[model samples]
Structures are given as structure tokens and as C-alpha cells.
Target: MKKVLFGLLLAGLMSTTQAAVAQSGSGPAVSYTETVLAAEIGKEILFRRALDWTENHFSYGPKTGAKSDAAAGTVRVTGTGKVTPVATNGKELTRVIRFDFVFRATDKGYDYSVGSFRVIPDPQKPEETMMLSDYIAQLATEKGNGKTFNDRRVTAQANALASEAAMSFRSFMNTMPAAEENTVGIPATE
Candidate 1:
């Protein structure tokens, strides 16, 4: 009877841990979509600007940059970047994150989405980025009461990076010359 009781208690604890972990929600992939201003101008300029932005902000090799399917009116880009964790007088750690960006162009405007982000600890080993809930769970375990990690701050920084990327494309569009009639490709299939 004592053995049975002990087994039951252990099972209960395991279930509680599973429940707590499950409650932490999905990961740190933040999806963002925006309508770009120069859709009618052709996707070429958009692709170019996106490539430039990726090169400047994210680490990309000579062969990397925007991948576009003109017939499908879609462009995708994937890259990784290193961000320094804010100062806490801590270890001065830098985190590397990878992201996927997709852009779909239309006649009047273009839609872009950014997501599929993860933290890459080593060139060979990549880990899922922690969501705000996951950080909160860590805080609880550490009894940090917000001292262990600033989840909100990290989230804000991620958002700011995304916003900056969008703004870069927008700025490029604003300064872009209108497309010549002959240069514009056929409208993408419905």
C-alpha cells in the first residue's frame, strides 16, 4: 500500500509538470504582415530592397537574399542575426536568431509576413526561441519576480527589429521611381 501511494504521488507530480509546460504556449515566432506601397511597380524593386535590408540587418552570404517566384508573385528570404542581450551586468551574452520572411505582391499593394524565428546556439545546434510565457515560467521557477529575464523588453526589441525591416522597404518604395510600362511583368495568376 505504501508503494502504491508513492507511485501515485510521483505520477501526480509528473502530470503537474507536464501541465505547467503545456501552459507555456507556443514559441517566440512573431508573425507580421504589411502592405507595401509600390506593388504595381513590379516585384523586382521590392525584391531588391528586401535583399539589401537582409544584407544590412541579417547575415547573408553572396548566394543568399530574396528568393522570388515572379509567376506566383511571392518572395521569400531567410537569414540569421546576432543580438546582444541588454545589460543586466550579466554575462554579456549574444543570441543568434534565424527568421523567414515572405512577401506576396498584388496589383495595388504587396503583403509581407515575417516569422519562423528561432535561436541558434551554435552553428550546428539551433533551439526554439522562448516566448513570453516561457520566460514567465522560468521566472517562476527561479523565483525571479521579473529579475531573471526581461521578457517584455526582449519582445519589444524583436518587434522593433521587425518594424525597422518593414520601414526600410517602405522607405525604398517611397523613393523609387514609377515603373515603366514595358518593365512590369504580367499580373500573377489568380
Candidate 2:
């Protein structure tokens, strides 16, 4: 009976420790999303604008691509950006960060989510990559001074990039297209 009670206590302590570790290491990823209210905008028009905005916003690299479905009123884009964070050792670590953009259009407005971030340790080897969340978690558990500095820097840089892109997208979406000329009243001549 004593042995059984001791075993139960040990198991409880281990579970508590594991839970604390998990909670401490896990955190929010650097991502951003927004829903813009555009009164009177049709879904088709919004979708077209979304496509145009995506094309103009991100320079298509070999790793970047976009897909648009008019019927579904959605545009999904996978884009990449370069981030150079100075390590604790004062060495600049440059990495390629891949992110996702999803634009969903409605008659009332559109919703956009611009983050599903992953970091490629080596740009040459795209497959060797890790999610930003995992990298941040690892950084959080790392030992030594300035460990959090890198974590903060990486998070800030990624968030900044995402915010900038989102802001630009919002501004572009808010702009009204030029009005078409009224050719019905004027006689056609060549």
C-alpha cells in the first residue's frame, strides 16, 4: 500500500512538471490577420482586387505562388521573405521565412490572414526548415544569457514584416477603382 501511494505521488509530480514545461515553452506565433469592411463591394470585384493586390504586392520568387478561385471568392498566396537577425554572438543569421496569405471576399468586405510562418535554416535546402513557433519555443528553453534576445528579435522582425504587408494590403483594398467612361451617350465613330 505504501509503495502504491509513493508511485502515485511521483507520477503526479512528473505530470505537473511536464505541464509547466509545455506551458512555458509554448507561445503565440508571429502572425497577423484582419477583416476589412468595404460597403457595397461585390464579391467578384473584391476577388479581382485581391488577385491584383497579391500580384503587385509580392514579387514572385521560385518559392512563391498564388491561387485564385473566383467562384469561391478566395485567393491564397505563399510568399517568402528574408530575415537577418544578429545572434547573441554578434553574428548575423540570415534566413528565408515562408508565409501564407489567405484572402476571402464577401459582398460586405474581405477577411485576410497573413501568417503561417516557417523558417528555412538554409535557403539552399528548402526542405530543411522549422515552423516559427517551434523555433521560438526552442529559443525560450535555451540556456545562457541573451537567449530571449534572439527570440524577441526574431518575433519582432517577423511580426513587423507581417504587419507591413497587412497594412499595404489594407490600403490597396480600400482604394476605389477608376470609374468607366459613359460611352452609351456618345455616338461611336472610327
Candidate 3:
């Protein structure tokens, strides 16, 4: 019975999970990448709020490939989308990365996790995406063989990508509207 229960739990977690890779201290580390916020609102209200926010911001609607579930005082959403990087010279890089995002919400707040990040080489070309993990591993391989300028460039790009995504998520949550109170914003007698 214990094994069965554990299996079920593991399955549930796996059902809604994805990536975060560690970058050189300058950026958000993917190691155990999970964010949890606290709010003084009801679970259902918070869940609905989160659903509305993501649906509005994310490119696709819930019915259009985004997975969402609300139950047991928790809400979970998973979706795939692309993030664009901006260059220092006020130019935006055309190369976009496809990423998997997992969001979990509760009465207090919510948690967002991004992983399975891959670069989509060309929009007009066939999908030839490379996983950020694989790219990082290749950098390690190159470092072992003595680092070159290209290796350093790749490392910097990966780190910047991680930083960009992290900031975007943080900003989104930070800017979310404050929980609204019902009935003239006054405390009701029990």
C-alpha cells in the first residue's frame, strides 16, 4: 500500500513538472527551480486569478494546448511558448527559445517553473531545436578540450537566456494585482 501511494504521488508530481538549469551566479539558478508566493486570499479566488492572468499573458488559451487543472485547493498549468532575447545594441535577436512552463497555485499564491528550454534555430526553416542542457553539456565538453571564444559566447548566451526568463517571471508575479476584498473591503462579523 505504501508503494502504491508513493507511486501515485510521484505520478502526480511528474504530471506537472519541468526545467531549470543552474547558471553562473549572475543569473537565476535552475537548481531546484521553484517559486512560491503568499497571499491572504481564498484558494478558489487565487486559482481563478492565476488562470486569468496566465491566459491573458500566455500566447495560447487554455483550450489551445495549455493544460490546466484545479483541485484540492491547488491549481496547475503547463504550457509551451517562446521567449525572445534582446541584444545590447537595442536590437532583438530573431532566435527564439521554446520553453515549457509549469505553474502551481494555492490560496497563498503560486509557483512557476520553466524548463525543457530549447532554441528554435529558424522560423522559416524546419524545427531544429537544441536543448539548453545539451548546449551546456557541450560547453563543458569544449572546456575540457580547452575553451575557445565560441564556447564562451555560447555560455554567455545561455546564462543571459536564463536570466531573461527568470526576470520576466518575477516581474509578472510582482506586478499581479493585489487580492481584492469583498463587501466594501470591511471585516465582516463572524
Candidate 4:
């Protein structure tokens, strides 16, 4: 009975440790990339769509610093969003996540890559920032006390942000915009 109980206890401890490592960003940094196929769509039209999508997705009254080069058929956008991770004490910790969106328009479709994730732990101290992957690795190395809970929350939130951005952009790019009416000098029938 004693040996059985000891074995069970050891198993539990090992599982707990494994869970901590998994939650602590033991793998690579979070990023998303996808290639979208738009049949019968010209490069210029796709370029315009990419610009419009960036503006709609990232703009909140202020300029999103989205730039596009028609000649090169590329659009670049820098985006920032907030993620709230609850601490062990149940207090919400707000972190700002910054990422980049690059869209390359081709004759048949477009390719987009979203990456370069950085997290600003404190909004007041913007200069003190670190990569999301680094933060997770640091958390993984810490003593597994109650801190692991918060660490897990942080990793989950950051990953969710990356996934959301990538999936939303993919959905937008897959859609077809309504055709614009060339109503120059046309009288209104209504």
C-alpha cells in the first residue's frame, strides 16, 4: 500500500510539472501565416481590398500607419491590441500586444504573414517591452508556486490574440467586396 501511494503521488507531481512547462511557452513564438486564393481578381483590386481591410480592422480614429505599394503589390500594417490576464489574486493585468501584418498581392491571390509579437507589460512604461515568447520562457523557469496559474493565463491570452488576428484577416481577405457604381453624371431615378 505504501509503495502504491508513493507511486501515485510521484505521478501527480510529474504531471503537474509537465503542465507548467506546456503552459509556459516552451515552443516557438506565436505567429500566423496564410495564403488566400482569389480567382479572377486582378492584382490592383486585391491591393485595394487589402488596404481597405487593414483600415477597417486596425483603425480606431487614429492612423494605423498602414502603407501599400501598388507597384510592388504589397501592404504593411502595424497593429496593437490589449489582452487581460487575471493574476492569482484575481486582479486583471492588462498587456498591450503589438504585431505586424504584411500582405503581398499576386495576380491570382494574396499572401499574408502576421508576426513580430511584442508585449508591453505596463502601459505607463512603454519602453520596457519584451517578446511574447521570451516572457513565456521566463515564466516557465520560475518556481512553480501559485505563479504558474498566472503564467498560464498570460500565455493563453497572448496566443489567443495572435490566432484571432490571423483568422480575422484570413476571413476578410477571402471575402469579395461589393462592386462600386460608376455613377458619374448619371441622373438619380428615385
* Residue clash pairs of candidate 3: 19-115, 20-30, 21-30, 39-108
TM, every model: 0.57, 0.74, 0.52, 0.74
Q: Please state the error at residue 42 of candidate 4 in Å.
A: 1.7
Ranking by TM-score: 2, 4, 1, 3
Give the local distance difference test score of model 1. Answer: 0.57
Q: Candidate 1 — which residues are off by over 4 angstroms?
A: 1-29, 37-66, 86-89, 121-145, 178-190
lDDT of each: 0.57, 0.78, 0.53, 0.73
Q: How do all the candidates rank in terms of lDDT, highest first?
A: 2, 4, 1, 3
**lDDT, model 2:** 0.78
Q: What is the C-alpha RMSD of each candidate to the true structure, in Å?
A: 10.7, 8.8, 15.7, 5.7
- Ten residues in sequence with the least summed lDDT for candidate 4: 56-65
Q: Which 10 consecutive positions of candidate 2 have the poorest summed lDDT?
A: 176-185
Collision pairs in model 4: none
Residue 46 in model 3: lDDT: 57
lDDT of 3 at 68: 64
State in Å the error of residue 27, model 2.
Answer: 3.7
State the number of backbone clashes in model 1: 0
Per residue, candidate 4 scores C-alpha lDDT tens digits across 1-190 of 9999999999999999999966655466677887877646778888887888887765322335678899989998878876675655667777777778889999878888877877787789986878887866665566652554655666677677767877877777666644622344567997
Q: How accurate is candidate 4 locally (lDDT)?
A: 0.73
The positional error of residue 148 in candidate 3, measured at the CA in angstroms, is 7.5
Write model 3 residue lDDT over 101-133, tens digit each, in one string. Answer: 566776566666655556565667635877755
Best by lDDT: 2
User: Which of the two, 1 or 2, has more lDDT?
Assistant: 2
The TM-score of candidate 1 is: 0.57
| lDDT-superior candidate, 2 or 3 | 2
